[model samples]
Target: MDHYSFDQLPHAVSELHQKLDSIQDLLLESRQPVPQTIELMTISQAAEFLNLSVQTLYGKVCHREIPVSKKGKRLYFYKSELEEWIKSGKKKTMSELREQLPSLVVGRKGRRH
Candidate 1:
């Protein structure tokens, strides 16, 4: 390794500290699961999560409006699938209109006028 003289030491020290901070952040992130990676919920938990009554939740399951896993008499719901089902019902807000643009707004090369 190249040795840093006293003049270069202070600046090198700051750079080393920044590198160590970034490594620490990476280690912490590796220990945690992502927001979307959640546990499966029971019928009661799923109903509470979706802010619906148990009867309403059962109605949804019967109507096949939501995603669920059935094992014998038990029902299981993944938060991710439930979230996706909710997202499927969402209509685009006015502010999100640009997201459905036919052309690239920031056209590259000869595409832009």
Candidate 2:
């Protein structure tokens, strides 16, 4: 260990304190609760979240049309997957379709640009 003179003691202590403060900050940050990525919902909760009737939801589940997880008699849905399922049925606007047309036309049997 390097011996510190009396004059250097306060400076060394301050530097040590700063490093401790940095470590404490990191510890506090790590202790913070992380946001949830997968939110599981029951069938009734799924129906409420999706604004659909329970009967209709059951019909969709029976037909294997919607994203679902089945455990014995219980059905589970993930909020993230349900949101993505809703987005997957989105109809493109005319402008959106036009924007995608060029990419779709390239290297296909059609009139060249």
Candidate 3:
């Protein structure tokens, strides 16, 4: 077999090293940890989390009807606040509604015959 020249060997080794380094960089990038910082929820995600339809969420945002923060074009919500607001708006039972309605409704005595 013909022997390879030393000059060619160094070039070949350097190319191999470069290829290995590129592969290592790619692997390192792949292994990098995803950031744990709160990922701003997309409008869809927010709606799903709130159990509301997209249109409702959009309406609230447009009217400034909901508490939110904006950064550039993105809207962010505090999850805790959203959860608290939902909890506070929990629907009253039928009995609870009945109890509340009597005070607002005029009795027969108060109504004009």
Candidate 4:
């Protein structure tokens, strides 16, 4: 039969306790509040922000063209995503207008010989 050393037992037990304490502290710290810089908006609030009718917003959501989340019976949106959608729509409109500009300018200067 092999004999165990008594001197090593206390050190091992103390190390185990320290590890447990560290794990407990980590778990406690994870429960702390995280600071959110962006605010979440409800569907109605988002629609109002975009100056869109609620029905139009709902249609976009149904078409999966807009970013939205459904929690229970209510819908939610991130303010940033809504702003991005608005900006992208504006960009598309600007591009379309630019494409049509040549047709709108009827007067052009001819080269003089």
Best by lDDT: 2
TM-scores of the candidates in the order shown: 0.57, 0.66, 0.42, 0.47
Task: Give lDDT per model, in order.
Answer: 0.90, 0.95, 0.82, 0.85
Candidate number of the best TM-score = 2
Give one digit per residue, the lDDT tens place, for model 1 in 29-82. 999976765679999999999999999999999999889999999999999899
Quote the lDDT for 10 in model 2. 100
- Model 4 quality (TM-score): 0.47
Where does candidate 1 clash, by residue pair?
Answer: none
**Order of models, best TM-score first:** 2, 1, 4, 3
Q: Which segments of candidate 3 are over 4 A away from where they belong? A: 1-40, 91-113
TM-score of 2: 0.66
lDDT score of residue 15 within candidate 2: 94
How many residue pairs of model 3 clash at the backbone?
A: 0
lDDT of 1 at 60: 92
Candidate 1 local distance difference test against the native? 0.90
In the predicted model 4, the residue pairs found to clash are: none
Question: Higher TM-score: candidate 3 or 4?
Answer: 4
Q: What does candidate 3's lDDT look like per residue over 15-82, in tens digits?
A: 88999999999999999998766546777788889898989998999997776788899878877667
Pairs in steric clash, model 2? none
Question: Please, what are the lDDT tens digits per residue for candidate 4 over residues 1-113?
Answer: 43448987788779789999999999999998988788799888998998999999999999999989899999999998887877877645788888887866743434335
